[model samples]
Target: MALVNDRFSKWATGFSGCDGGDIGSPHSKSIWYCGIEWGGGHPDDEHELINKVLSNDVEFPSEGYTSDDSPPGWLYNLAYRFNWQAMKLLTAVSGDSITSYKVFAEKVKPFTKGEKGYFKMNLYPLAFVNTSHDLWKNGFAKATGLDTKKDYHDWIKANRFPIMKTWMDTYSPKLIICVGKSYLPEFSLAFFGEELTFESEIIDDRELSWAVNKNGTIMVVLPFLGNRNGLNKNVSIQKFGDRIRELLTTL
Candidate 1:
């Protein structure tokens, strides 16, 4: 069965506030737990927005827009065209929260090389990877104790990989960048057929590491760009984004 939702979510323009396990909900139980949350937005200007993201300049909204006057295609612009820089740069990510997706993209924006764009990375279809959507939602628990590291690892492979495999197969991105190095083993095992090795390198005086899947998709390990922290502690995430951009330039 097709695991990713081809339909643009009902909240395509913004976050859907529905809680889990509801009937006829935009976020169906299946999607709440497993569907690829990115893509399928069916943006109003797919080609135009994509071209901007690819060749011209694309910028994230300084903050969420509340005015009804906000352009309808902004969602397509922010979320897909430019907002999620990591995913845009590498084309695949395993994130659960919409906030985190937006944060990382924003954080990386300032660090981006120029007003024009961030990285010269290839794009791919089918880009979200929640690992387990049920894990991050508040006040929610799972059949497995998703909070535990061991249990989390178990859940991702047993429940999430099949869905991810379907997505990876469908899109076949040239790279799959993971937030936090913790998942490299599982990620490598799932998509690359074995435990791929990584090499650490210094870029712009900062250090980072990455791996490559046998399928030719480069796998990068980065800090979680949530509200808290990212690749560097002493530096702001904006700077961290710049550092990583320099590192990726080498890759």
Candidate 2:
């Protein structure tokens, strides 16, 4: 079985709305969530932007007309092309509420201004970590309760941890890779605490990969694919592909 979440349907519907010229459609009701813009009805241009930003050389329609106006099908095609099975799984789980997915899709929609085309760029691939309110309060800190803070960590602890664990247990991927440098410190502190040990070579400022376990499952952190600055100097389009390939080898 594949892992999935509610964001998939939300993305599909949101993109469908954009294609149909409904910019302000409500995709998800959650506070930390908002639908993607897709440059407001530039469905055709959005397709091209996806190819360029992802650095893939493929021709996709820049018009509202797809092989079919089936937004879900289009989303699936994009996911497969990008090797984002995680996205597919999330959509599958969405069942009827595809909030996250729709928001992401709409955000990446393309637009052209005068002679220049604009493409939305994402700075990181989604990272899944194991956590919960109990884990944070008990394992991490009592002060880190859900009510006081509601960032990504809190969101994971409150909403995503249980589902994330279930998915990890079921899918059992050999390697879990995180996509950012900033996430490394928090991830390390979150799971390892003061007992964390790093491989000497990876401790340098360059790209680092290490094993972190929670309830016996292991995770690895790599440079963010979307972070063009900071410690991810070498993390270009080519590097992103290489890193993913390396991760697959480990898997």
Candidate 3:
């Protein structure tokens, strides 16, 4: 089957928090990584992340992760995974270059905890959304605890799209970048209220396509953002930054 047909096991999303001097630019200091639901959707009790609203002393999964009951294939690194490449893209556009993810994480610490920004890109709440495909996989390690949260799941079914729209509208970042493009159609449905008809344009290494909604939020779909402990080699952060900026200029 095609990559699009495969179910993604990774799912994460966030909004940055830093006053963007250049607010109008697509390369604005803010960027978003639409999470991954790794592990072929094993132990996938994914929720809308009400945990964020409940108590957020630390980020998600980092707080919820417990390996004792987790499935055999469960990769521990999935917890608290940040998109360093996404951060690099932010640094590239902002001119406030960061050398590593460690540096970027440190800088965003205050803001992630809800430090007010005068013109901040606000990365707090680290909003996460599980693709509908995150579930529906045939596997031995099916999800648990889903029975108790039918109401929450109901809310997710009804409000997930609107809530996502709210997040997008509130941040209003020039560019809305997603980690993987396999599920691009689902993303289009969420943002634009219909499936997108798209044609890819090859930009040196990767083929990219753009979908601009009525408000002009350019959704740039690409592969997994960067290395997860030296895996997911298909994603080249350096190449992405180079080609993305160039592509943005053409339109």
| Candidate with best lDDT | 3
lDDT of 1 by residue, 1-251 (tens): 22312122111111221111111111211111111233332222434323332232222211222223233222322543333343332222222233354554444331132221211211111122333433332111121123333443454455445444544454454444454455556655654556768876653354455675554455555544332433433233344445444444555
Q: Over the stretch 91-117, how does candidate 3's per-residue lDDT look in tens digits? A: 443344445434544454211323211
lDDT of 2 by residue, 115-195 (tens): 111111111112113212232222112221223223424444333334334433443333344445555554444334423
Stretches of candidate 1 exceeding 4 Å from the true structure: 1-153, 204-207, 226-229, 232-251
Q: In angstroms, how far off is 217's CA in candidate 3?
A: 0.9
As a TM-score, model 2 comes out at 0.33
TM-score against native, each model = 0.40, 0.33, 0.50
Which should have the higher lDDT, number 2 or number 3? 3
Model 2 weakest lDDT span, ten residues long: 28-37
Judged by whole-model lDDT over C-alpha atoms, candidate 3 comes out at 0.41
- lDDT score for residue 52 of model 2: 31
- Model 2: residue 57 alpha-carbon error in angstroms: 34
